[model samples]
Target: MEIKAIITGCTGMVGEGVLHECLQHPDVKEILVINRKPCGITHPKLKEIIHNNFYDLLPVATQLHGYNAGYFCLGVSSVGMKEDAYAHVTYDLTMEVANTLAALNPEMTFCYVSGSGTDSTGRGRSMWARVKGKTENGLLKLPFRAVFMFRPAYMHPTKGMQHTQKYYKTLSWMYPFFRKFFPQYVSTLAELGQAMINVTIYGYPKKVLEVKDIVAAAAITGK
Candidate 1:
């Protein structure tokens, strides 16, 4: 199946990496990104819409039609963040956009880039994990074709990508060690993107995918 996907958070590391893969692949025929600012990349298959308010997508709802998939890569750090503030950005904001999309495109398969150790029960000790868990559960309740939650531990961003975040320099160096010692926790950005595309196109058994499952889906199938 040809993928015409709407990608969020393209200005960030994970989203940028995923957008790069989508542009390079043959199966992903089109991409639309809604960003607060320009993502600074271009392709014939790509079109971008700049909008600051993710909470209110009604203004751009017309442009969101005809897409078969959504890659929700937008996220913020919870360090030193309070519960209410974190929930507003992480949970409420995500739901605002997701609810609109699910209604507009009922057939759209939504893939969310959540981190590993996310709490499914919403009772985890970690604040961030609990919030992420709530977001995952909320999306599952949406009336879309499917909602696949991706729980990657640590990602090695694509080498030389201009948007690769500064903090990742520290993590990039540890990628090799993590891959060797803790293979399940380490996955490349490229694999994460491919796995998302594969799951949306052909579908997967699990609603929530971990690092190993993400790696396994990276391989493209002819049939």
Candidate 2:
């Protein structure tokens, strides 16, 4: 089967990593990227759509209708954002995309890049965690054929750096040491991306997948 996908946050580290893997997969026929700025990469199977705001999706909703999968990686750090601003990014923006996509392609598989320690309970004291939890819950409510919430911790990436990437870089350097002792809490960006693609291509047994599960799945898929 040829898989058609839509990827948001294509310029981000994890997003770029996943995009690379998508291009390498024989099953993938096309990848549509929606972002605020250009990714500057060109490929016959790739389409880049630039938009200033996510709300602009309303006008192009039809173009997003036929994708087989959606990898939603767009997110922001909650450290500096006000509560409303953080919620807008974590919950509002996510729900907007998921709802729109669900309406357009009810059969699409949706995968989200979520973090560990996310409080699925809406009443959690941690604001960001709660917002992410709410977003995850709301996305699950949508009528997609498959919906998965991926919770990864200390993701080790081979390239790219943002403020958080530096921290992960430190972890990546020490991964060999940690893997020998505590292998449960860490996962590579390659594994994370591959695991997500596998879940979308195959079928995930659960709605939420933790770090250990993701690593195991990635290994089985030889990714």
Candidate 3:
């Protein structure tokens, strides 16, 4: 089955990486990216829609049909923000978009980029984890063909990508050490992207995937 995917957060690092992989992969036939601003990319397989408001996607609902995959990579850091404020974006915004996709494409396979240490119980002390858990829980309840939550702790940025975080320059050198020592907590951005794509095409045994699971999924051959 060919993949016609709607990818969110392309202007960000994770989304951009996933988009890059989809562009090169043979099974991904089409990609639609919705962003508040231009991601500055152009390709025959890519269609970009610049919509300022994610909360209300009614304006572009007509154009979002027929896709079979949804990669929800949009998110925000909870630093210095109150619980309610963080949850508004982390949980509310995500659910709104996921619901929109679930309605438009009932057969869509949704992949969400959560993080390591996410509290599935929703009662964790970390505010961000709690909000993410709520988001994951909410997504699983959506009426889609499948849903997978990816929890990656530290992802080494793909070389030559423009959206890499500024701090990676200082910390990226530690990736080898982490990969050898704390293997469960570290993976490359390429692995995360490939894992999402692979899981969309070939289902995994679990709904929630951690760094090790992501690594294992990335190695799954599509051939």
Which tens-of-lDDT digit does each residue in 129-201 have in candidate 3? Answer: 9899999999999999999999998899998898998877578999899899999899999999899889999
lDDT per residue as tens, model 2, 12-35: 877887787787778889999998
lDDT of 3 at 74: 91
Please give the distance, in angstroms, between residue 163's alpha carbon in candidate 2 and its true position after superposition. Answer: 10
Model 2 Cα displacement at 18 (Å)? 1.1
Clashing pairs in 1: none
Report the Cα lDDT for residue 114, model 2: 88
TM-score of predicted model 2? 0.92
- Cα RMSD (angstroms) for every candidate in the order listed: 1.1, 2.2, 0.9
lDDT of 1: 0.93
Positional deviation of residue 210's Cα in model 3 after best superposition, in angstroms: 0.5
Selected candidate, larger lDDT, 1 vs 2: 1
